[model samples]
Target: MEQISTDVAIIGAGPAGMFAVFECGMLKMSCVLIDALDELGGQCVALYPEKPIYDIPAHPAIEGAALIAQLEQQIAPFGCVKLLGRQVTGLAGEAGNFTLTTSMGDKISAKAVVLAAGAGAFGPNRPPLDGLSAYEASGAVRYYVKRREDLRGKRVVIAGGGDSAVDWALALQGVAAHIAVVHRRPKFRAAPESTAQLDALAAEGKVEMVIPYQLHALHGQDGVLQAVEVVDLDGAPRKLETDVLLPFFGLATELGPIAEWGLDLAQHHVTVTPATMETSISGIFAVGDIASYPGKLKLILQGFAEAAMAAHAIYGLVNPGMALHFEHSTTKGVPG
Candidate 1:
């Protein structure tokens, strides 16, 4: 097995994990980032890379792929080590000295560990319907719309009441020839503004609102979708003719091996101290969506703040006798 050593071992190369590298580098600490995915960005790059994100602080709106591109540029100067396409299957040892074993039969030794794994090991929640796999294989049913251009001039049926459903409905309005939104209830679980926009589009005859209905069956042959069958409270069937069906039912996520690390767990997340972002086990910290605390917000911005806190706390463990004189970014410029 190949052996590696670092000051901090960051498990997950998402936005938070990438930023953790910068934060640790600024404090003169070397880091090694490990992730199951082959690429840098976690969900952003894998799922919905073209989707627009409106709440990223400075930029009014940015796509998932673009946000990751900017993050890659921001952390380029640090030149941190990356162990992609590998999953950390085992963790052992104590604070200031820990070893992590990966799926690729590699061992990594680090002084501290940071868990920035956003909803570790996630996949879409597909609806339970017969012949679904055929459609999925034929590109008729998809959980994510990687590109809108693929749906151009095609009839699309979007099912769900969440943000993803509403957002995609609005995004593909002009692109798709016909758009129908199917939901079990009239009320949407998405943002009020977005729901209102969807309502406006419905009123304008640009969208069809199939409310109080749930997907019941799929009508197709040989992996080609002919129409979607839905039902209401009374079991009355309604068929929606469409070329494609997008079910934005959200993702099914698991903590995976991180759950067995002996850290305190709440639900599926690691319980951590908000002050330092450290887990119940010393020297092993948790951040991003995997860390749980009082009033925790699952936002990328919040994850960035938590990464900074974890790095500051790890500094103490890496340099036991030394003090971290806090200096603003303006005071100390980044490495060239």
Candidate 2:
């Protein structure tokens, strides 16, 4: 078993977790970050790299990938140990001394732990259809868009009514030879601006809106999609011929082994003290969407604030009885 030690161990590489690294580093604390994804940015990169985000403090608008890149740059000075593509299998010990085991048979010993995993481990909610696995193996169906070029010049059918579905429908307009959007309702769950763009594209006859219908079946040869069978509210079937199908039914979240860590859980989220972002177990903190408290806003900015609190609190555990001389980044500058 591989063993490592740090002042703090953060269990996510999302915006909040990355910011935690910066915060801890600012206080002269060393940290190690672990994430299940091969890369950082968590859901931002995995779910919607091209998705635009507003309401971030400084920037009025920023794409998901851009925001992640910026966060990565912000934390680069910290030089925290990054253990990517690993899941925490077991957590042992207590405050001031914790042992975390990963699926890769690696062990991390840290003075404090921070749970910044956003929505925990998430996977796309696969649409229910017979032979769906077979079609998926053939590459005709996908849960998310990894490459825009793959959809270029292809007949694509986007399924679902959420932001991801409509956003991709608008994004793929010029790239796809023909596009169709299938949803159970005409109403979209996407942002108004994105929905408007999709609406405009449909009005321009660039894309087809197959509304009030649910995916009934998929017909294809060896994973090459020929047509998609959908059922309308009236139970009438319609066949849409397409080469590819993109389903954006959202994600199914699971905390997995973390749920068994004996922390106070509210639904799928771990409950933390709003004052210090600490969990029931001392030295173990929770932040981001996976962390919850009264009046907790599930925003990136909120998580950022929580990370700061968790980092400061963790500083105490890492260096017992040591008074922290707080200094602004402008005054001290980021330590090299």
- Using Cα atoms with residue i matched to residue i, what is each candidate's TM-score against the true structure? 0.98, 0.94
Top of the candidates by TM-score = 1
TM-score between model 1 and native: 0.98
Question: Residue 8: error of model 1 in Å?
Answer: 0.7
Candidate 2's residue-wise lDDT over 246-315, tens digit each?
9999999999899999999999899998989999989999999999899999899999999999988888
CA lDDT, every model vs. true structure: 0.94, 0.90
Residue 331 C-alpha lDDT in model 2: 88
- Per-residue CA lDDT of model 1 for 132-226, tens digit only, reads 99999999999988899999999999999999999999999789999999999999999999999999999999999998999999998999999
Model 1 CA lDDT for position 39: 99
The predictions' CA RMSDs to the true structure, in order, are 1.1, 1.7
Top candidate by lDDT: 1
Q: Count the backbone clashes (under 3 Å) in each candidate.
A: 0, 0
